[model samples]
Target: MTKRNEPLAELVTEAGLSEGGLARRVNELGQDEGLQLTYDYTAVYRWVRKGQRPEPPVPSLIAQALSERLGRQVRPSDFGMTDTASLATRALTYNSDVPGTVDTILELGRTELKSRGMQRRRMMTAPFVLAAAAGPSRDWLLSTLDETFDQDAPRKIGMRQIDGIRGMFKIMQEMDVMRGGGHARVTLVEYLSGYVLPLVRRQHDQEAVQLALYEAAAEQAYLVGWMAYDDGQHGLAQRYLIQSLRLASASKNKVLGAHVLAGMSDQANLLGYPEEALALARVGQRGITISDSPACMADLQILEARALAALARDGRPKGSVTEAVRRAEATFQHVRPDNEPEWARFIDPAYLYGEAAHCFRDIADTAQIDRFASESAAEAARQHRARRGALSQAALVSGDLQRNEIERAATRGQTVISLAETVESSRCIETVRDLTKRFKPHGRMPEVQAFQARAGQLLKVA
Candidate 1:
């Protein structure tokens, strides 16, 4: 049996309270905070003996209540545990004050970027998820929109701060593509709660502030959806992406909206919902066509082509890939970001080539796939070595065409799988899975079997 005089029990005794008494106090505290706790003396005893921890907001409330009743500060450590800090903890603490939340979130973003994948252990901790689920989205929305900007005293954030946040976003995006959303989801959630939430509270010129808020909200929503996708929570991801689209729409930033829509379309395509993917890509195209931004138009056209390729792969709809390619070629003629977000800085000729290659590969057009795949691979290699994520994507396209050789494709596939384990994106895994599934129907070719085996190994990790 466990010792009765454990830290929590000792603390309870020190306060002149029995296990039942402590549980009652905790319950009362929960009541004050609008939470329902079914905990009892037995629960308290288990926590004391078995190291079970209470959910957050509860832990803080217990501390507050014990301090009030005993006339002494009751630290959670006194009960053999640290304070329950979660993504929602900071957000909830500052929900009544937007500026505080924004400050906390910015600091959090910087911390996340600096640490890279080191902080992933805390991503899906129980308290963090509980708190994130409890976030006051409605309150945040109201507060964000209520503030009008003062043109005379507009607040200016430093470029360094923005860059730090962007860098974090980039890393997370890459991780999500490589590994799927499961590994570092909590980190992304905490990022939104600590960095993006606070920015939403800032006061600025109406137009500028609104634009900033919309972008931030869109990013937050995208991260949330990406996390959900990683966890295989497809329904949740869809909902969050839809919410992100709404936020983008509110800002009237069609470019960002198109990006989010493309993401949604990508998710749909991966889920085998090719028709839905095509429809969403069409929406993005329509939005881009009407906008004055040529670069944004090109990006959307590429996205549309990807969706069209997926539809063609599903054996539905005529001229999908052809139409997509035609539009993409036209957009390529006028691609430049006059005033684009930092997140989209890398969507260049290489990106178009890569996306086009994937589309042709999906349609099983070996010649076109080879042509675009080689060009994309070379372009991606030329840009940055740190883009293991993009390289993995290009490798997937190449793998699709190299289906005849299990040995040749297996080496490259293994490299991608290794890289995929470190990143947080589901797209890479989905691509590999799709490739494997496509080849499975062709019977037991030695090379295909070997590639499938390698893919299976990677899927287990994902």
Candidate 2:
């Protein structure tokens, strides 16, 4: 016999919803994700009275519905439908406590290892929780990072060892650029879980030595997060980025911390939460100063522009978008690669213009897209063509589409396919899929059909 589900029953009541209302709400939310749910009052009764669980997505859909009603970050575990081990559940907290932060990060890496490869994405329809990111972004903004190294335990780690680790990660970063995060993110996780964890555990009498170790670890973790983002495992990336931010904070490395926050902002924008994205980018801007690398500052500024452009497209004024883009371009001119931190050196012209093109696309400003996107694609690393080049080339297709140049857009789309095929990123696949969606209206045309046929073969979307 099943026990009563008091938690679920109480939550429904606290949300001020009747069983029928909750069922209808879940079905509505499911429809947003293309799920045809038949949940009714009896289905809610089975959950509340008989401890019966709904199928995979329905439970998450219920959580999302109640979260909106309650105006808080609700989880399946909150109502006893699942446990805290769930990715969204585990990522919900900022872990302000001392060893709890460390432990939480370790557990997250372990969980990633056990998640049966990239299949973790299949666990949820909407994986990245915007609310989960909000808590940590605010927590880091308010945090003093006063936590000191434990002097009573462990051994000292030298700067040379940290340098060596960075040297190796440089190669991994290159691979991620060329081959996509899917190709190397797991191996990166293996290194973080095995070798880096021990380094993080070691203590030293020299504060400088310890800080270097923390900074190095934070950067490595940030790379893992970046790879995960590139691979399209956004929820997993969000978790890793929070941990990386904490480590950077612990090291008192404000520059790296700002970079991590900027990464968070980019992820948020890409995930369609431009408001949260803008807020995160502002906090990142506030967290650093002019003394920091100009490249890092420029990156944040462009991210802000991207968010503003997204908002503009959603009915906000274009004035803010224009100003933000100007600031980004002006700041990018100040980027001195030799003076920049190794991590920030990637902020080259190609990268800056690539992002600029994206912002212009969001606001439906095709005038600048041709110049910026073409520059981005042309300036792509000559030694190895990668996902960034593919993404930059994609903006051309969008710009062409916005102008009703179906033949030109389809022709350009084949170039995107050629560039995207060199990498294993799901983000690349998703990019073409988005273009294909736009191509649907013009599908009867021979040119449009050609692009659709090619994109369909590459995307293989369900």
Highest TM-score model number: 2
The TM-score measured for candidate 1 stands at: 0.59
Clashes of each: 17, 0
Candidate 2 lDDT over 1-462, as tens digits, reads: 988899888888999999999999988887887988888999999999998876566767888888998998676656765422344565556666534555556656665665442334343232677777777777777763333334333222446777787886787888887798888887887887788767778767887777777787888889998998888888778878888888888777777888999999999999899999999899888877655668988899999999999999879998888789789888877777777777876688888899999999988889899889988888885645568788888999999999999899999899888878888898888888888888889989998898888888887742
- After TM-score superposition, the amount by which residue 18's alpha carbon in candidate 2 deviates from its true location, in angstroms, is 45
lDDT of each: 0.59, 0.79
Each prediction's TM-score versus the true structure: 0.59, 0.76
